[model samples]
Target: MNLTKAIAGRRSTRDYTTEAVDEKLIFRLIDAAVQAPSAMNQQPWTFTVIRDQALLERISQEAKACMLATTPVGAHSSHFQTLLSDEDFQLFYHAPVLILISGNEPNQWIVEDCALAAENLMLAAYAEGLGTCWIGFAQGYLNTPQGKHALGLPAEWTPVAPIIVGHPKSAPAPIAHKAPSIHWIG
Candidate 1:
């Protein structure tokens, strides 16, 4: 598929089918994610794939509780609140597959590298007729002790992003993209 089409088609899917995503497909998505650019060629990243139903449920519950605790009263940030519904709070659309991305501490550009990886994965999933939502709200929960145990994250790996993937239960409509703000030298 062309890059334009993929870009136009990609959306943050919040509803997903219960159908299981193939392991091979998940790996393929990761393969695509690694293709993203990193600073100084330093690829400091790790991924934790969660497929166990019980574990996913636990993570979801823990995450929701964390959100409730962290969300300041009356503060509604779309990235942290609007996307987290009762049904989608922790598991995030219950997509049956969740990809947890972490980065090494020493790399100053870990955040950028991890974000690029996430975009690559989301777009790749869309191209493959799958749906994905980049989940950043989970950071609050994942930063805690329970979250760390749930994902089996190493002490050295900091959570950068988590993504939920599955077949779309509802197709996302195209959203308007803002015009680029740039100053070009002739």
Candidate 2:
């Protein structure tokens, strides 16, 4: 797919088939992610690919529990609280692969850098005829001590993005997007 098409057609896939994504494609996605621009070229992102079904299930359950135990502070929090409470909810949506992006340093731009990489990964996956979803709900739990140990990530490495990639069960309808507000000053 062309860059324009990939950017315009990429959607957050919530449901996926059980087919496993190719390891070569996964590496290509990571290569695309690293191509993203970073502040001062720090490029401090680390990609952890997870394919264990048991671990995915455990992380989903634990993440939901952790989110539920926290006090809701706003409408966004309240919405997540409701979603996490649903017994059928799985954070990774049963996708066969989960890519966790982490930052090695506690730098101010680490999160931003990781986010850029994640966008690249998603767009690349879409271009490759794959589905991808950014699983933000897993962030809190993945950053916790227990979660870190479960994923075998170093304590200094902060989890930035949890993305699931796989073949879509079915094509999702195009979602209408609002026009962006623009301001220009000369």
Candidate 3:
């Protein structure tokens, strides 16, 4: 797939099929992710691939509970509250694979670097005819002590991106994007 097409056509896949993604494809996605540029070549990302269905379900439930228990204070809290209150919501969208991108160190650019890697992974998945969704809802729970222990993450590593990858049951309609706001300068 052309880079432009992959970039523009990649959608956040919520409904995934039961078919498991091949391990080779997952590795390819990781290869693309790590190719992303980092600040000072720090490359501070770590990838945690979760394929256990039971564990995925547990994390989904725990993450929802965690989000709901927190005091609603932000502008996005109401939206999240709706999701949390919904009994059928699954943070990973039942995807067969969950790729958790963590930052090895706490630094100002860690999140940004990991996010760049995430975008690369998502686009690569799309190019390979797989679907992906970046599940931000899992971040809070995945960062907790229990969550870290459950995933066997190092104490210093912080989960920055929780992405679900799988075969899409159906393709979502193209989402219209807003026009970019540009300020021209000399």
Candidate 4:
């Protein structure tokens, strides 16, 4: 597919089919991800591909449990409590493959690099007739003891985002765009 078509087709998909995504496709997406721009070409990013069903279920359950452990009296706790009921957040829309993007350093530039990599992978999946959702909740999950061991990430690695990739159960409708506010340019 052409770049324009791929860009136009990409969307944040939270619904996925049970069909297993091929490992080769995941590798291809990661290859595209690494090609993304990095800060001074430091390439501090790491990709963790998770495919085990038992591990995925464990992570989902543990994430909910950890989020529920927050003090109920806290202002933010109620929000977390409500999140546990959401199915998408619970199982990550049941995507077959969960790609965790981690950065070696917590430098601000590393976040930018990881974000670019995520975009590249998402577009790559879209072109391959797949769907993707960039999940931020995985970061919180990684902070918990269970999630840390589940992904087997090193102490130095910081989980940035979880990219859920799989066959699309339903394609999201086109989102309307608003014109950006801009300053004058020469």
Q: Top model by TM-score, which number?
A: 2
Tens digits of per-residue lDDT, candidate 3, 1-186, equal 999999899999999999999999999999999999999999999999999999998988988998899746799888889988898888888899999999999888999999999999999999999999989788898999978998999889989999999999999889989999999999
lDDT of 1 by residue, 1-186 (tens): 899999888999988889999999999999999999988888888888987878878777778777866787564655556655566455566778889888966688888999999999999999999999877667778867778878888777878888989999889888888999999999
The number of the candidate with the highest lDDT is 2
> What is the lDDT for 181 in model 3?
100
Residue-by-residue lDDT tens digits, candidate 4, 1-186? 999999988999988889999988889999999999998988889998888877887788777766566436677667767777565565576789999888977677877888999999999999999999987655687855567777788777778778899999888999988989999989
Q: Estimate every model's Cα lDDT from 0 to 1.
A: 0.83, 0.94, 0.93, 0.83
CA lDDT for candidate 2: 0.94
Q: In candidate 2, what are the lDDT values of residues 96-180, reduced to their tens digit?
A: 9999999988889999999999999999999999999999789999999989999999999999999999999987779999999
In model 4, the Cα lDDT at residue 51 comes to 81
Off by over 4 Å in 2: none
State each candidate's clash count: 0, 0, 0, 0
TM-score sort, best first: 2, 3, 1, 4
